[model samples]
Structure formats: structure tokens, C-alpha cells
Target: MTALYPLFADLDGRPVLIVGGGAVAERKTRALLHCGAAVRVGAPRLTRTLRAWAAEGRLAHLAEPYHEGWLESAWLVIAATDDRALNARVKAAADARRILANVVDDPALSSFQVPAIVDRAPLTIAISSGGAAPVLARRLRERLEALFDPALGALARLAGDHRAAIRTACPDHGARRRFYDWLHDGPVLAQLRAGEPAAAERTLRARLDGAGEESPPAHRLDWIDPCPADPGQLTLHQLRLLNEADVLVHDAGVGEAVLSLARRDADRHLLDAGERKDPGTLRDKILARCAGRGNTVALISQPA
Candidate 1:
């Protein structure tokens, strides 16, 4: 199996070519449209919706069979045709041009695989199986959909609005991280969840100004047990915290799958039986390291 590096592409206003007009192509077109991508279809025939979009001048339609030059000026290409030879040709053309191509249902010929996405505007969560088990990835996406609140987008927008001010107030990276931790864990998130945006903003400002009630300490250790063997099995909250961690202290038995989810720059410390000889002493040592540093530590343990 080929190892793939996962990343999100910014397709806003970028030209994307779709080589089929079937349901699959239509689905891909809708997703592209959501991202504000400029879509161009090269199919001889299009789905009814695709035809409507073209008639409305939303996209360019070739109204002809696939050809070589269609790949020109395209940032990305999707081969969703039922014809194997045509899909192969599209893949080959995209490969020669170094353009990223996704051949629907044919991972072997494609350069990228589109993940099942949970869209919350600026906050999107994508789950992929590296073209190994798409259905499983979809199932995981569905599970996450229920866990993330739709109001998160509103909360994110609020944060974005105050980002400059927050950065100015908290010049230190660690201090900024603590402020965000407070924003997410304090009354601000609750107010937003309750649909009280004004109240949330008021609280956010108060906290930023240090006028609000004392926030929960940001420097603390989170002990996580029954750690997931597969990164895909981790809960959304776990994944978020892992990505936020400044330091990760884990037992030697912890799997790389879990560690890989942490921020790439996070400091890692492996704990052996010697370090575990006194649990309280180890906890104190970790806490001391975090003091005045605004560092958040994640202490992981294997399932007993």
C-alpha cells in the first residue's frame, strides 16, 4: 500500500475539470461548487442538474467527448466516466501534466482520493481510508457529524472576528493557546451553543481583557486510557486535543497511530517503568515543566 500524505486543497475560484456527466460527476460537481471552484465539464451528455448549471452559466460545458487539451488550464481533474479506456486516458493526461486527478472508484489510476467530508464552513473534518475502505470512512464521517455542533461555525466566525485583537493581547504563542483553550472550555462556547451570540461575544471580550472570572488552568495533564490503536478510531475531541498538545508523555507501549495525530512540532517523551515508579512524582514533574510555560501536556496510557 502506498503511503499518502493527507492535506486539504484550497480550490476557491480555481478551474476544475470533470470528465463525466453521470451521477458521480454530478456529486463531484456539487462538492466543487460548495468550495467556490470554477467547474468545467467535458462530457458529451450531462445529468439534468449539470445541464441546468451550465444553462445558468454556472459552469462551462464542452458538449463533446473527452479530448487531450481539456486538461489544459485545469488545476484538478475528476474522471467519473463509466468507460474504462476514457478514464485511463484522463488519468494518463493528468499524470503527464502533473495535475492531481481522481478517477472515481479506481484508486490505482488516481493520484488523490477524495475523503468523506463534514463541512462546517471554515471547520471541515475529512475522513479518508486511503482508497482502502471508503464505506468505513463514510461511516466514521457520519459518526463525527453528530458529535460536532452546527453552531461551531458561528463560534469560529466569532473567533475570526476577534483574532487580530486576541493576537495583540496575547503576543506569546503559549498565552494565545491558553486564551483559545479558555474560549473553548469556558462560558463563551456555552453561550454560543445556547444561540446567544451577543452574550458569547461579551464573555469573550471580558476574558480577553482579564475582567472575567478566573479561567480553568490551561497547564494541566490529561490522562487518556484505552488509547485507540488506529488513529481513525479516535474521537473528535481526542483528535482535537492531540493536535493542540504542546507535549506528549506516553508509555512505551503507546502506538504510533495515536502519536501521529499530535501536532508535528509537539515535544514527545517516552515513559518507561522507571518513570512510572511513582505516579504522583511523575505527575508533579510534568506539571512543573508546564508551569509558567502555558504548555498543555497529554499523558497517554494503554488499555489495561
Candidate 2:
């Protein structure tokens, strides 16, 4: 069940205890420190950096091996000692206390497995294979590191800063999604990658400004009307219409393969109808911008 849960950051000052002084313990300690956890390490000795942290009083260290009492007050625990018996003892203690525990290279004793993490600042990607594959995970991370530009972290931060305004402007979930689609498209990302921060900010702000307009055309109300299209010729018309749309509002569909031919970065929406179908007035304004610039707007139905 924990497998599906996201790896949340330790930004809330969670207490983590690492029981070891070796290289594995050192690696885990560094990661926890980077996440801003208040870390306490229990080991008979320490590495150079661990000793420095203790000297600086940045983290607490116990000059001893695993003790049953160390389990108290720890939110998460890591057993990285070479001693198998001690690692097993620590795992049992953690299980009794319901604390998340990770034993280095020991799957059965672990309640949670740490992934090969990629940190691009503000953007963190964790890859885990349920302990079935660690080397594969590292290789995958390496591949992803090449694909995911470091600039994405900065863009993510910018998006975070403007989130409130974005929510207000693009009130509907669908519209808001479309805006993000536009955001990740070549132009905006290119500007950011080129170090044109002002241009990027201006582009995003302009999008927000456009989306917040009071009202728009009735045809713009919903990306796809509730009515389903007839098969055959309608599909062709849908395809052609998709090509003309500056913004394409599409839900999960069997026709996605067809739709992909339209525009590489065209805004696509996946609508789960429980939420607002149309994000809001602001989104319509962005679509209007596309239309004004002679961009086509297409709405494709979800695949059956």
C-alpha cells in the first residue's frame, strides 16, 4: 500500500535516526540532511562529514551502536550497520513502534525502500523498483537525468510562486491543465533554458492576465460537449478540427494516436467530470489568445 504513496520531502522537520557510521549510512544521512530533516545518528564512530556535523551541532550523534531506546521519538529509522543481528534488531524495534524503517541492502527487513533520487532543486525524482532492481533504477535515473533539464526545477519554482494566481485565474481544473500544457511547450521552456527569466515571467503573467477575463463565447464554455460524436466521417472531421485548434481539449481517448499528429505541444486536457469541466474565465482568455493569433482550438473526446 505504501508503494503508491509519493516520497514526500522532510520539509516539516521530521526526526530521522540513522544507525550506522559506514558509507551507506553516510549516503542516507546526506540525503536526509538535504531534505532538511533533523537527523540523529547512532554509531560508535563517524565519517569525516558526520563528525563535522556533530562538531557544528547541526545534528546529534550517539557514540554507540543500536540501542532499543533509540527507537523512541524517531519518525524514520535507517539501519546501515554491517552487523546483521543489529539491523534485524533495529527493524523489529521499528516495526513494534510503527516507524518507517529501511535496512541497507536488506529488503525483507525493510518497511520502505529508498530510491535512486534525482535532485534538480525544487524538483525531486525518485525511482524505485520495490527492491527487485536497484542497478536498473540507477541506470533509469541516469537516463532521466539527461532528459530532464535542470531548468525544470527553476520553472517548477516559478510555477509554485504563481500558484495562487494560477488557481484564481484558471479556476477550472481542465483549463488550468491546458495552461500548464502551454507552459511546458517549447517556447516557454526554451526561454527559461536560455536564461531569459524576464521573458519567461512575462509569458506566464500574460497567460494569467488573459485567462482572468470576465467572460467568453458560449462555444468556449466546454472543451467537448456532453454529446458523443457519430463514428466514421465525424472522426475525420474531429481529426481535421483538431488540426485547426490552437488549444486542444482532449480527455483520455482511443483516438490519441490520431490526435498526436496535430501539434507537438498543443494543450490537452484529461477531464474527470466530478470537478469543474471548464477551469474558468481565465483559461478561455488564453485560448482566445491562441485564436487571436489564428491558432485552432480542438476538443477530443475520451477514448472508450
Candidate 3:
């Protein structure tokens, strides 16, 4: 199957319809409500939680089965009914209106797949297996959920709050990158983790105010061992450097799969395979790159 387009919708105040009264429908309704969507459930009967939510005005409950009218004003619809025939009818109605619809557990009828989410608030990560391997997707999400610390969101928000000030202080794009690198690597996040937000803010302010250490040398070469066929095999440290690198100097044997991990705007210099025999060639290339802006990272891999 082709890759699905990934999207995050702002459903605040937007109307959406769910055509089931079961546990699955309840799950979908709660998620939509959390996103501020105006949820309307069109089922003859609802589960206990759904009934309670309807009573509390959390969502509008239609005491009737699925119909074409429900799709008239909906931004999207979830057909979670146990009846496949009924679900198919809902899918057809939604299709006639050009509305996006997802029939639960039926990817063939779904216009969009709801990915397994790793919610870090401002830093949400989503994983999908193209509806081919849902268990695998959930497993990946679990790993990410554990890998990312809860305080990471606080760190992101703090950085967001200082965005304008950071931009103004570090006018040079390269300088701004270094400042952010320092911000992430420095004591600010540690202070936040220690439950000292005030201290964290002070540290951030001090750095922006030039009371912090000077920006590290931005023009240097850091080489990685030969890249494996899969870029995912690289360590986190290596991935971080690749993500932040402004320049990539590599032998042609290094695949695009690995090169794609670096900043899309980074400069790429492909060294001659034969040049590896003589260390002077690479040294000269690094020297030339050092004369310019930003830092360089080379992948000293096997010759093509």
C-alpha cells in the first residue's frame, strides 16, 4: 500500500460524527472531545460512559441508527458499528459528500488511518504501519512513550516561550542553531527536571544575555564509522549530530538513506573514492569547509 499523508487537524468546535455505540466508539468520541471537537454520536443506544457523557452534555447523542444526514455537516466520521453492512452504508454516504471516513478495523474503507499516538502534549509523536501491521505500530509507540521523558514537553514549551527573544539575540541562523544546541545540552532542562523552573528560566536568560559560555566552534569535522544499510542502526549521539550538521562530506558509497537524515538545507560534498587513500585530501576538504559558515560532519565510509 502507498504511504498515507500524515496530518494533524485542529478540530476545535468542528462537528464530527461517530456511528457506533460500543467501546470502540467511546474511545473515538473521547479522543475527539479532548481535541475540542463537537462530537455527535448516531447510534440507537450508547455504552455506559457514552450515556453519561451525553447526559453531561459532553456530546450530542442521536437515538437512531446511521443515516446520510449525519455526514452533511461532519468534518469526518468514524464507523465503529459491529455491523459491516451498516458501516459500508456510512462509508458510501461519507464518500458521496467527499467527507473523510474511517471504518474501524477496515482499512480498505478508511480514507485516513488513526495512528497510534505518543502524546507529549506539544511534542506528540505518531506511529503508523500503513494499516498493514497495527500491533507493530503500537509496539513502536510504546517504545517511544518510554524513551521520551514527560519533562520533554516542558522543555519544548519553555523554548517556545523564548522564541522571539532567541531569534532577536542570535540573528545569524548558524548562531541561532548553536544557541538552541546549547539550550538543549546545557543546564536549563536539568533544572526543569529538578523541579526548578525559575532556575531554568534564569539560566536561559543568562545565556541569551551573553553571561553563558561562548558558542562552541561551529566549523569542524566529526566523522562517523561507515554507515550501515539502515540509518536506524546509528546511535542516538550520531543521529543528533546528523540532524544538526550544516554540512556533510562523505564518500559516494554512503547511501541517500543516511544522507537524508541530515538537515535538508545542509551542504553536501561527495569526496572522491580514491581520495581516501591519501589522508591529505580529506584534511584539505575539511580546511576548505572550515573557511565557511556552520560545521561539517563527514561519513568516512568504505569506498564505493
| Candidate achieving the largest TM-score | 3
| Quality of model 3 by C-alpha lDDT | 0.85
Predicted candidate 3 versus true structure: per-residue lDDT over 1-304, tens digit per residue = 6769999999999999999989999988988998999999989989999999999999999998677877878999999999998998889888899889999969877998788988877888989888888889989999998898787788898999999999888877788887898888789989988988899999998889992345545476777866665798988989988987888888877899899989998888888766667776767766685566577787877633
Evaluated at residue 66, the lDDT of candidate 2 is 72
Off by over 4 Å in 1: 211-291, 294-304
For model 1, give the 10-residue run with minimal summed lDDT. Answer: 211-220
Question: Which pairs, if any, clash in model 1?
Answer: none
Q: Find the number of clashing residue pairs for candidate 3.
A: 0
lDDT (Cα atoms) of all candidates against the true structure: 0.84, 0.74, 0.85
Ranking 1 against 3 by TM-score, winner: 3
TM-score of each: 0.77, 0.69, 0.87
Off by over 4 Å in 3: 211-218, 224-241, 271-282, 300-304
How should the candidates be ordered by lDDT, best one leading? 3, 1, 2
Better model by lDDT, 2 or 3?
3
